[model samples]
Target: MTSFRVKSEGRFVAAGCALIALFALIGAPVIAQEANMLQAPAGMKPSGSVPESLKSDSSSATLAPADETGPRRIVPPGYGATTPSSGMPQAEEPAGPSQFFPAGKRASEPSVRMLSAVPGQDNSGIQIGTLTGVDASTAGLISEQQGGLGADMWQGASRADIDRYLSRLPVPVRSPVMNDLARRLLLTGAQPPEGASGGVSLLAIRLNRLIAAGQTQAALDLGAAAGNERSPAVAAGIARAALAQGDDRLACDALKDIPPGNDPAHDAMAAFSVKLSAYCQIAAGNTEIASLTLDLAREEGMDDALFYSLASEAAAGITLRAPEPNKLTIVDTAFYRLADRELPENAVEIVEPALLQSMLADPSVSDEMKVAAAERAAAYGLLDGRDLAAYYRKPSFTPEQMAGLLTSDIPESSSLRRAMIFQSIGMAAAADERIHLFKLAFATAESAGLYYPTVEALYPELDRMVPSDALRPLAPAAVRAFIAIGERSRAQDWLSLISSGGQMLGRDARELTGLMRVSGGSPQSFDSEKASAEIVSDLKSGVRATQLYAASEAMMLEALGFQLTPAVWDALLDARGALTGDVPPEALLNRLQASGQKNAIGETVLLSLDAIGQKGPGAVHPRASAQAVASLKAVNLESEARRLALEALMARSNAGRG
Candidate 1:
């Protein structure tokens, strides 16, 4: 019985051992997964202590102290822990799963691990760098090498002074040389004047002046070069100029760049933005938005009846007979074009010369109107001479008008008369007849105070004609016209014809010689004594206007480095009695001298324009003209100074004749 019991006990122990082994095998994977959950991923640092429930209780399964300095073993739950006994074999805890799977397992799937956010950290309003101001005065489309004033142009002047001078610059500058100078000054990329706050006020003034002066293309170019399209004032100017140029797309893009709540300070500009925004929306086919914008503009107190009427008409595809405003701004003119409405008969009378430029190409206008518009535009230096010449060629004349052009009573309509003369000159078979027509054209234009425009239109035609003996009697006027347009080489050619034709001692020859000398030419028969005597006679006996003209002639000659006799200088002082109406202020002359002495190029230019005033170089006092020329010379602008002097001479001479 004892033997049987021992055997049974042994059998029972074996069964229990078998059961324990089966339970261990089943729990191994669960324990391994739990260990993985507790262990840190391959790149992450392990944190927190093993769970108390999973800690081994056996004293021999010792864990290293939490504060121990050396590397500690990470034992998984259910594993017996032991310190490393010298030379005893010990198992290393299993490493975390391999980051790179074996080749076959790589194709199983890819997994993404999302990280948790750190506590109490703020990620709002994070910026990379500090913001700073832009130097807007450095903006320009022209470089110094391309005839711009240098970048240092405004270096010595104050911002306030620059702003004042720029504001004073004449709109529709009638003198071509002054017009050119004004454009160059406005477009030059120069340093900001002293005391500038890095704002665009100075630039805005320049752009506005350019737009007001019919230099819309220049204003557009300058605004683009400035890279300040985001500024409301600049964008407004650009939009207006673009509209004036008939580029609705460009205007829309400019208006769109203006940020909300940054409208310009001027009422006109603010109104312009509000009205043009609606127009742009309509142009872009966003009719609903256009309506909303127009409504918003009205609600905001934009009181431009012309614009609203035009915009409403455009939106509804119907004509609203809007009465012409007393003063037509560029925006009004552009909208008038968009609405396809005919301008009033007195449109030219009320509109600025700058606005007249748009009508030159409008097919709806009569040819007579275009000619009249081109004449005014050309006179204001807004239209190119070649363009005016082209307009002169547009009118079709009847055979009767052509046959009686010179002989018939002059047409009542000045436009028809000028066009007939221009066409007749082109058709005349004889040189004398052509030359006579040329004289007649100039004389006809002169009678109406349109001499300069006539000169510009007919210069190219006269320039193409080769000078000869037969044309000598007519050569003096041609020479004068050539000199007026700065075609000195061509003028010299005609002067040679007069000299070779043996008319050197005639009144025309003496006058031509003096003019040529004053315009920087070296004519063959220039008699300084004879010219001086004639000038003195005019200054002594001529009317107050004629005396002023003679005095200006003497001053210009002296300015061009011609040493007129002392009597001429004394005569100029005598002629000062004739100075009436508006004269350049003494303070302005002082400031101009100061600017010149400092070599402040831009300041000198502005002050010079001011000294010349609205009526231009011809109408200003002789002292003003001479001072302007001298100041310009002081700044090393010899070419400009010479040209200014020549224009003054020509303009005064024309005024004398009139």
Candidate 2:
């Protein structure tokens, strides 16, 4: 009985061991698949697990009484919070050796392996540094396509050199062509020169120069266009321009817009701002603030006696007999206007041309002073000819003055003479009488060196006169004036009248025709030999003045793309003896040529203007004129070149007549 029981227990134990082995064999593949899902592949770090802070606290868990809320859903660990299974297929597991190793089986080798080095890891061709300069050169009012010198206008030049050259440019450039060129260069939107960082900016210098040259409106427009109105220097210029134009409110507002602690680069600009602040404060009825501002200015080293006197007078409503200032600025002028003080007699002489427009509008100014200011302003292109014409129409003339205008003795004062003639031409009954009056007017203006201004003033009258055989006697003068003012169509009409007369061309008519051609008139053949011989014979005969003028005309013709014989150049050289002024240096000419060759448009224009100097083209040396024309043409400024040449010819003609 004992042996049978022992056998049964042993069998049971053996069966139990066999069952455990079967269960282990069945779970081996399932464990291997789970391990494959958890392990990261070669060359990749394992993704981070859920942070401890974000894990649920099982120890703090509590059971709440149930309500009618929706059923609580169960989510698996490490799932469903961020990435839920939508209906898309899961990514296939990385093909590699399984993390688990079954007994008696070696693990397969990993299909992916780590790389030794990454591609593009070399840094030999890379530059590592910080940029150190501020570039503000791209601010301008005009573009290259809008007649500006292009974005590359200052290439091949440094900021220091460009600033120096611009500083040396003549203010109120006398020649119209040079003036136009200077204005365009200053207003162009282009890149700044190299190393332009942290100083008085180029834009500020440009704005100051424009204001000094009586181009205040242009300076204001440029500052506005550049969106730099808040800069202290630019803001100061805008305020000054506003004062010059009698817009006190605008001036005050411009000053008010400047940010605090941003002082202007110029001491004069700082002083002007101080005075303006006081004046604006007074005008706004803040008397205490105005007085305090003035006190602060004095404490801060503003020593301008004129400004203090004017401000004191305005603030206290009392007049002070202050000594006259040696120089007057737009600020001083504004204060004077505010204080109701009569401007000094020499104000017209010392005042900048920019202030002349406001001066001309002042009713208290003498008629003579107004006329002088108008002439100077017109010459500088600050005022239109029609503006002077309006001033001329203000005075009334007696019937006798009008009747004897052509035959009577010319008035000694140029203003009265111009005014008299301007009036008489309007009332003249017959065309012949008007033509005589026109010739006298032009001759009088030419003698006084006011020919261009007179031409502008009388253009409407001349435009109304029909070109006919009867008016042929006045053709040369009419055509010359028309060409001087760029009225090419009118010049052509007068030139046709000269041709229609069917007479051999006289020296005056031939020369006038050549000038017309240079001013973009209809194309015509020129007789270079005849013109040169006439000038040469005149030179030999000691008619130096007339022939010198003729020589310049011939040179101008040749420079404007008209072919002239070598004899013409020889005659021009001989005629150079009559010129007594200093000629442009050879170095300047060389620089101009070099700039043109490099296509440095702004530099070329500046050097050309410097070569021309303060005098108009007519007064410059012919060599300078020739080189300027050539350089301008080389840079594709054909229109400017032609206009410059034409001006030279017209100046010579007018000078010869004088």
Candidate 3:
């Protein structure tokens, strides 16, 4: 929301041209204007003959000294000197064509005095390009003179009105191809007619591209002009653009123009910025940059979120291992302060997880800073599947302190704070196995007086933040192996390491033993002896008895000399849930007889079942059942095997007890 506000306010519209024209003409010495003049970057002077036709309609207006409280200068994308965003879009490309995930998020709005085309209330039908119904003559005139010039000219003609004039021209009429008349006139001495102050606004709309193109010196020179002569609004705008375009040094120069204010907007903005930048510099693999930036942002007022954004990103990058790629530094904070100076709102959310990511790694970020960072991240409300490298590195929240967040008079700020709390709750839930932990975390977040309505606050950022180090990094194969090998301790450990919110479905040894016994004792036809042996083999192999009937039914029938009842696996499954936790004693007895085994093995199955029932979840699970003992008689179709089975059970069970 803040970023969006910044982008929209950064470039003001001319609002019928009168407002800008009036501001520019209010106090100027009405020099007889000649042909329209072209703008040029500093050191590149323009000199050319004026067209005779242009001279015929020369115009001039009186202009005023700019008010100290005039509106702020707007910044275009890629304008900051400190923010180093690559061409990386915010999302991955595999899901479809190239597109950013968590789409349609707006840029941040600055709180500083807004430099706008006009009050938003002034007009309704205007297009960003032109005042909707202007006469063709005026359009043609502005169009013919306003089109075609790049980085250098833009820096000089950086005011919003110039951008507005640029917009009014139809694309075809505003061709960049300069004719001899136009080019020659620019070569001749032609100062762009003065703007609102009868003075050129140094910070231009085209500042970003110039910076991108490695024209840093030009930006600095323009900034110097603004610093020397413009109001805080224009100066700050230039500073923000330079900062965005990646030159903190120039940004520092711009910062000097920010007035001395007790409200601390400037101070906070500056302090919060470097505090984090220093930390992130180390985390994002640039200690020097982080340190230097940190030192500079420190000069910002404590209220500034830029400092915090840099700190959090630095800290989070180190802690969580994932850093946000599209980190817009302090562009929005500067504006937001001017928007509502007395009641300055926090500006941490504009360039999020980057702030979130960068801070996690910075060792210098103190505990108090973390609390500040977590609160801001939670408020931003991370989305599902969004990179959460920062949130994962350290606790996303602290339960202790939440001041005027909820109580703030501005409902919007309060609501945003609540949203942050809700997100923190979710993070807590993921970390602590209990839902209660999540609730507590969330409640603590809301206590800050922030508002949160839905889980929507913590968006599509799937459980990606649950880190490997934070949680046991168990692979699917590892989990499978643990399950197969009955490594319950290890399995549970892994499960706990991951988020607390998942289910497991592994069979218990005790449950299996009871199942075998219940099947063994059930009434079945034919000889019980062969049935007993088949049941034991199935149990050892972890196959259910019903399945045994499908393949082993033939062997059992022949051995029994008679057919038994239906396969027992199905009956076991049916009755299993009702039995001990899952296997009822009665159901087990029934399944026992259904196995078509003898009285001997039946005893072994029952004994094993009974033992497990007496002992509980912690008791040693019987490898063989009570009936297997009774089946001991059956097992020694050879006595040696019978003895071995009994010995193995006793040894294992006793060993378990010891």
Candidate 4:
């Protein structure tokens, strides 16, 4: 009887174990099952010390200790719901462009927003040319027609009629528009009244006409004349005119006649004059006084956003305080905006980035104010694409603010600023977002005829981030950018990529690739004559702006890393139209040797051998100076090389010792 009982019990136990295993495999809620789910022998109690009902409730009700190792069931507030599989909620998506990826985006996407012609105003409708409605004769007629029927007719005339009658009104006229019309007319070449003595005021009007007529030199000469010499406004206007023409010396001299705090009766006019004086100071490299003059302008209530923003730029390395609201009145602010657009030379410097960032942070600043400040900063090179990216990195900003930055006025003619803004957008974007922005900046620059420096900023990141196929359209810009940044190998890499890509190359790209190939060759193999001719042709072609050609030549020369032979030097100088200058070769040499070129001192031993073959000991040839200096330094022959170079320079020039 006992043996039979044991066998039955073993079978029962085996069945119970199998049942638990089955529940585990099916992922059933067996742990939380009620007591009724299992049947116990009539006289047997549960195994756990606590009653099954109470124990089950206690396990579910009690919270886990902080350090306990188990699954955490409690989620803090706002963690809405967990995934059944993963048991953790997903992060919310960030707002803005990241949420929307435009489809079929080409490598060269177009973001054709106009750059502000004026620092803080619409570039449109602000004519630097002749006044639209009024000719010189009509202006004279308007000045002459002041008394009887004409005067009465003009008195009730609406602003539009005045505009219709006046021709090109230079600036917006405040009401009581006749005198304003009369002043503008006088300034636009209308003859002043016969008995009205042509003093400084009359000369001021004539100076304005001269400037309007594009006669900058004549206006400058007039300002220096006896009668006009004492007029601050005339001086300021002439200085402004001179600076616009790149005559910084003439501008500075003109400004000396109008000292800061030379307050005229009209505070607004005085403020305008003072701002011009500051620009002259900047052009003359008189940054200290420029800063002081800007301060005085603000103190006298010159709160034009352009003035302050530019003042901040000129005062780089100094912390500038923004003007009070009342000081920057709408009318005055509008005038400054007009001045910035009308006279870009006046505020050519960029506002400091840190100060601009502070302005962006201030809640009191209007979107328009921020936009104007940012645009001016960028146009003048105070801000860049990296700065733009920083602006976007913030957690919150209005769509209007983003739009304002993206569409801020850069001139269609300014490739540098356009390229810069485009690159800045790329710099601030995530890796996934960069490709489109980079291509857009490059494409826009090319479309607008701007071959720009900002391309250099995009080159190093191109290989990994940009696909091989998208590179063809970017070839010219890439070559130029790489060369400028002194990345000769990378520029070669671009050429290699394009050559191997099985795509047809553009003419400009082909030329650039050929140039790079020549540069990469041995010094003896370089065709200096042909290269110089090509450089001249490129300059004349104006594919890139003329001013940039010199820089390109400089880069090419540096990239070759060869000691320039006299023949080569002659060719380059001839191309530059600088061969006949009395300027010492030392100056040119100094410029070439400075940071960007980084020529490896041509093999020092080779230079010595050449010198030995050409000249006696210690007689370093003028053409060999570059290699001599670099090689000497490389082989610890620096002092001897220096001596040899100085001797050559002295032999080459009649320049007296400093």
Candidate 5:
């Protein structure tokens, strides 16, 4: 018992090394030993150095609670803690980006995977390849806006958020804080230490402040220096802010600073910057700009999030906010298209927006194609969904009537030309309502480009024709959405939407067409055109195109699990060709497969082989089994046996005959 008492006292003496000598000099009250200290010391040898009696945790020796309550070992002014307490809460949440970081926080590792979702669970989307992105600008702005800015600087933060949560200095429109942080950033050299999170935090704070203060130059410098170190959210915000300011240059500069090595974030930043640049340039009236900003955004080749955003934007103008605006975002979906150039009668002043986006991205698309595509997109953009395919009800116009107003700048809409005009003409009719005719005629006459109808001019024409009732203009899905939302009315909205979409509605052929086989100007097989055709063919067979499109569209998606395959499309086409002497299945499949995609002709070959097997080895194609078996085997498909077996049964039916 006496030995146990002596050991407990020794631990208390050793517990407060820094405090021990000082307490004695102040003549402070002697500290009492607690039950916790009464246990065996950490790392004490089991080799019997200490008495076996002291090893037991049942020691009765204990110090009474201090009678003279002096300052505790580590207490606040009101804190009464002397010894560690027990039975505390088990689970605890740790402070992170929004909390305090340690000194040299820039070097401190941030938890890319946070535990905000649930206990013992994680949903960190952060990838090893995408780490080191900048978030300081965003973090600083968050602190500034939420009134938590002072908390960071005052109490210091962890190494995770941005290094040091300091206040950002204000800068101007052209200057970013790049110069200010340059020395410090350089002093740390190429690599930061483990706890340099403070530096990262300070850099972010400075960046956000400069951006808010309109110091674009400094922001640009900071962005460049940070390189691919910013987070996706941060890069996106900076790009957006730059664009909102109408400074395309700064936006582009900021985007370039995003490390090229970043995964989706860099691509996301690129998509935003490229789209904005194209729109801003066009807005400034660069009607004839012959380069490609929109194209780069499309094929940024990363950032799926950005891709969806851009596509959504492209569909926005025509299909603004209808429940399903995209349903009408097509030339065939337009009303009042012109027959000559294959435009909707309502289309006016939209030629440049459509045609120019592609020309700006890739200069090689034929002038004729650019003009046609632009017209289609513009027509779709201008259309009102309530009356999709309602052009037949619209009264027809005389050739002279059209030529009297036909302008030189009218751009052609590619495949959409025929469908859009056909739909428009279908909707034309001799409705006695004066407003109806006026709306159609007025829409027909206004031609700044592909998609525009002047209400002022059209109203008078309608009054001249029917001269009764009011005209109503409800665009096809998305187009109507824009009208209802007045999206085009606002300069900012127009710019934002335009920058957001320009290529969202583009035909895959447009993208693929650019990768031309120069020898004969054939579309590169891997382009959007082949994918669209194959996908469409699959859908036209009764399935909606969207479902089967997943195979060709999503790179990671598996081929359709259904028995049907793209070969079916080619085989049908081939049979149609062979029967009509138009295109043989074998010839067509072989050609189409080259640029269209694998398995494009797989089903066709399968059917052909099955037919051959039924013909008892005299199949027209003669090599169906080999073709089907080979392709199926490559995908680990066991359906090969089925194709061969089905052929055996067909042979008995004698399909070899007509």
Candidate 6:
């Protein structure tokens, strides 16, 4: 629970920081805080401090009134049932990016510059002239559009509402400001202000805002403080919010008002509440109470699809000791999953091997859970390569799913065991799953330090795995893996298939495959500009971090050669910048100059590298450092090349530790 609070607070604080940064970029003036601004709901304080009030029985506190007839609907501004209409005028939403982040502002202008060298001048020969001024006021808005906490926080929240709230602040704090603003706005609209006993609409709105901001503790505390308005509707709302945030204890506390009872409503809401209550009980470790609660729900007329579907999660963990009455039934698939969770131990009465095989074949059981069961069997020395083979031979799971599951939760050391399991099973997998599984086996093998056996089993399937002509474009990754593992023949086979089918590899993929071919007399090749563009595409497409790191590593390997492509050159420069504190400038300069020999990369690259190395601004607009070193070496000026290399290394070392 302490750790949970720490983690939750961290998440909220991070969100708050993002909001603050967004507000700063938008030119929103920060408001000074009154003493009350620092106040938050009990238990919502930063980690390491707990309010004594929260330490008490939180559910016993007053709650906002609930309407048993139906959920509360917040009346829009200007439509009040009790007080005279305030008639708040609605502001039309911003219609375009310009409305929010205005253009033509001083910061929104752009500038251009031109560079030329006076013929045969020394290092000082080149001059850069500004051709245009630059404005960047719209830059912040464009970045926000790209996605961050600012975007997520602003989502579904009206800009008008936020602006009104901000205008009231003397100086806004970060994320907590959003929560406070939400509370203030809700209260401002409440017909009977703060102290008055009214409907739960204000409380509901505030709690919703808190929940959206991931400030669940504040929401729970606020729900408990709503005095006379506390009702089943309000309590249920708070409980639902708690459950959504994974606070089972808070949810259980909120739902206590709606205890299990006979003659529950036959409608969907009642059914859903009943199901939620049961799960809440289970989560709170009151298994017997949960079981009874679930039974009572079934006893009522709650057979709707929505109720059943929500009930499935709890049903998946329930253990039935004895057969129950038919009326107490639930979806069978859910019950089977519950049984599967306990696996070999629960299935002790069943025979070996078959039990393990059945566990894999069961669709309701997740691959992750199955992996756990297999690991458990392994711990007891009962797991066999044969049983593993059976899991793959039957083909209920895909290689990608299994790989993801195996890696998702386990310790790094367990990856060794995973490698062993894959090696055992790869040979027996059906053709459809074989290549993918072998690839997984190969990838994990390196980490396990058991590369040979994994590759030995994988080599045979290489040709068979290459997709047909139209699909060749998609198998570059498969080919790259073969090259990485030194299976040159298989790599060639796949490349030939791709070529025969008349498909072109993506630039990065082509360059990578070319690196493999370079060992077989094909020239080492790369396009630095194309590589950088490809990297941006990968980032935009949300490629996983692991994949990005692999790509970066490949670029670094290519940078080792004398001819630096734009991509490789930039990657090396970035790497050098990243490694600044780790390696001294002098050592790097010595290494680059000592290794110098050049082909394609030119003088502009050397000049940039020289400037960067010397802690000076680079003169070039487009390319960078390693290109300069290679370019210098290409012109047969070994002495100049070495000096520039040394300078670049020194500058790199002075940069921040990556």
List the candidates' TM-scores in order.
0.70, 0.69, 0.20, 0.29, 0.19, 0.25
Cand. 4 TM to true fold? 0.29
- lDDT, candidate 4, 147-188, per-residue tens: 111212222122222222123322211111111222223333
Q: RMSD of each candidate?
A: 33.0, 35.3, 31.1, 38.2, 32.7, 26.1
- Model 3 alpha-carbon drift over 4 Å, by segment: 1-235, 240-246, 252-363, 366-368, 377-389, 392-433, 449-658
> CA shift at 21, candidate 5, in angstroms?
79
Could you tell me the lDDT of residue 155 within candidate 2? 83
lDDT of 3 at 141: 11
Clashes of 5: 109
- State the displacement of the C-alpha of residue 108, model 6, in Å, after optimal TM-score superposition: 44
Ten-residue segment with the worst summed lDDT in candidate 6? 96-105
Span of ten consecutive residues with least summed lDDT in model 4: 1-10
Q: State model 5's lDDT.
A: 0.26
lDDT of 3 by residue, 376-446 (tens): 44333221112222333333333432223234442433433444444444444444332332333234433
lDDT of 1 by residue, 181-239 (tens): 77778767777776633334667787889888887766765665555323566666776
Give the clash count for each candidate. 0, 0, 160, 15, 109, 35
Error of 5 at 344 (Å): 27
Q: Top TM-score: which candidate number?
A: 1
Candidate 5 ranges beyond 4 A from true positions: 1-194, 198-201, 209-239, 259-658
- For model 5, how does the per-residue alpha-carbon lDDT over 222-262 read when each residue is reduced to its tens digit? 44445444553345445544443333333333332333221
Ranking by lDDT: 1, 2, 4, 6, 3, 5
Backbone clash pairs in model 1 (N, Cα, C under 3 Å; residues 3+ apart or in different chains), count: 0
* Residue 308 shift from truth in candidate 1, angstroms: 2.8
| Model 2 global lDDT (CA atoms, 0 to 1) | 0.60
lDDT of 2 by residue, 355-376 (tens): 8877776666667667777877
Task: List the lowest-lDDT window of 10 residues for candidate 3.
Answer: 171-180
